[model samples]
Target chain A: MSEGKGGGETVELLLPATPERLALARTTGAAIASRWRFTYDEIADLRLAIDELCLTLIRPAQQEGEPRRLTLAYTLDGSSMVVRGQVDKPNPAAVNGDGQAPQPTSVSDLSERILDALVDEHGSERTDSQLSAWLRKGRSVAAP
Target chain B: MEEVFEIAEYSDDSTPVLSVRGEIDVSTAPELRDRLLGVAQDGYSTVVVDLSEVTFLDSTALGVLVSGLKRFRSAGGDLRLVVTGRNVTKVLEITGLVEVFPIFDSVSEAVST
Candidate 1:
């Protein structure tokens, strides 16, 4: 299948939810965004946004050897790119550290706002056994 | 494989400083965290992080820095950063942390301040 120059393509990655492997996800996301003709600044934003999403998925349990796997599904739709991230956890809200969530002004909430600023639009939802976040950024005219 | 990140420590006017190169991401943040914490634990009144050579800086790394900053401030010292990369600066701006830290354009400026 030819994705064509600046054509749309979808890339999916599944990796352990370990910090050591998080770099792989960031690099892959940036590479795919670059292929889609995103600008350097756009690619940088995509990398950091994806990094924040992945960090949100990290659980202290991960350090105990019951490593979880994160599935990142990224789609480049010609004019824009969208990255959907999911993990094994059922409730995305459950990923919230403690029942008492951080205030919108708290430092813990700062990362989420950073992701919000980096991407054109972002959202997250949870399912029976999966927690997912979707990040989107438009392609630049210079991309070919 | 070249280290994803490298840290070099030095003293500028007797103020401890960390010269960090490469990407500051999840894979390498812990090392940075440990080193910064160590500096604080050792009772450095003030410290500067030179991130001019950092190619990428992520939220995890920022969290570590903020944690370190808080640690230092509570001890009556302060943590400062020298950031030059657009990528690093962009994140700092977006997070509103650009106002929180004393950011300098050069190591000398950060150290002198």
Candidate 2:
């Protein structure tokens, strides 16, 4: 765990990039969100956001038959939480022989709309050797 | 570790009801898809998915439900939902699925309508 600038806590998790493990990610997010005093609805949104981010990174790895791992960092400050995740680089052998970089995995339209509505900010970045996604949600003042 | 996800099939009078419990994510969505496909293939025109016991749902599960809805509608039937959980309702609302699927508060209401 790391300390945020606001003296908040940040938890890091590394797990196998498999669908079965998605629940663990969601559970961890929910637990932290609850501790931060997020509302029930806010916690639910965080859970779904974390699940969607992890699954987006895991799909390409599964299709490639590579046993990749996913790393997630959940950072909670005074009024908001940010969750970020990255998948391990794929096998060099799996790279296209034409020296072209693989396209970043695309989220479905439904996933896009859900993420847009749930998080205050979210996006993904892809480099030749790395792919990552992140989302930030703020606690509503009405939350207890 | 895999989460506990269950789907039970029973009849609400003459209509088929799939009662699902637990979290539905990427891993468990295939099971849901297969069961829904099974219902569609069995020649059932209308089916009700009881999600009152469901705790969570992600886009993968939503995609499966949308596909199931399409399959049922294409067969000249319909797929309805019985939703109770806040999380599930929020998801459906987020995706504009509340307008697509006939939603009810109870299984009996879903079957009766």
Candidate 3:
């Protein structure tokens, strides 16, 4: 856990959606999770979900033929660390199939698993809040 | 932040025992995948990755493991991993890759058998 100033006890980092950057997010998340006292299992789940989200976001970027970014942010909350990120790809699972967008099968399945696991861990409301945060300000990860 | 990463090395014809240190996450997974791919390309018969030092794992790393194992196994080679951490072990168990790849408790034991 990296030490911070005062009692604010908040840590944040921004990473792109590339594989290399995704890897950094996982490593950074793990470190922050440890700093915030997340259980081993909690830390593992958070990392897996992060990878899945980033990959899913990648699929959309490929579809739009534009550069889409995955941004992850975090902070030390109370007991569990909150990870928030945007999969800049228009929710692959909800694609309209309007002949304008294509969704990758493996990646979506992987993304679903990631979302499902996170939902199980923190519940739908928390998941929604996390996603909302991402939509509002790139992405945020909070741990306490 | 401090980074924990290392290459798990081995040679062909010899039972490869890879020593993995630090957390196997999205960022560092490619390095691991490449290392395992090298072993497969070298035509090794058995590769045992030592993960006792690993403290964390994610699905991306899990995918790398899955594909790497398949690549070697398809060529009549094999990839086994030895992991002994609660979190790491649980990831394998949850992902159900433990059954896909032969698992062991230690490097010495993984190599002996």
* RMSD to truth, every model: 3.7, 3.6, 6.9
lDDT of 2 by residue, B1-113 (tens): 44578999999899999999998888888999999989878889899999999988988888888888888998888999999988899998988988999999999999988
Which candidate, 2 or 3, would have the higher DockQ against the true structure? 2
Please give each candidate's TM-score.
0.86, 0.89, 0.66
Candidate 3 or 1, higher DockQ: 1
A1-144 per-residue lDDT for model 2 (tens digits): 889667879999999988888889889999988988888878888889888878667877777887888999899866889888888786554444553224333236777788899999988766577667888999996435
- Candidate 1: CAPRI quality band: medium
Give fnat, all candidates: 0.62, 0.79, 0.31
> Candidate 1 lDDT, tens digit per residue, B1-113?
23457899999999999999998886788899999988987879689999999988876788789888998888888999999988888888988899999999998898777
Give candidate 2's error at residue A64 in angstroms: 1.5
| lDDT at position A2, candidate 3 | 36
Which candidate leads in lDDT? 2
Rate residue A48 of model 2 by lDDT.
91
DockQ, cand. 2: 0.59
Regions of candidate 3 where Cα sits further than 4 Å from its true position: A1-14, A23-44, A58-67, A72-83, A87-111, A118-144, B11-13
Query: For candidate 3, lDDT tens digit of each residue in A40-143?
Result: 66666666665555555454555555555666556444443555555443443334434222334543444455556453442111132122222111113443
Model 1 residue A38 lDDT?
83
Question: Candidate 1 vs candidate 3: which has greater TM-score?
Answer: 1
Interface root-mean-square deviation, candidate 1 = 2.3
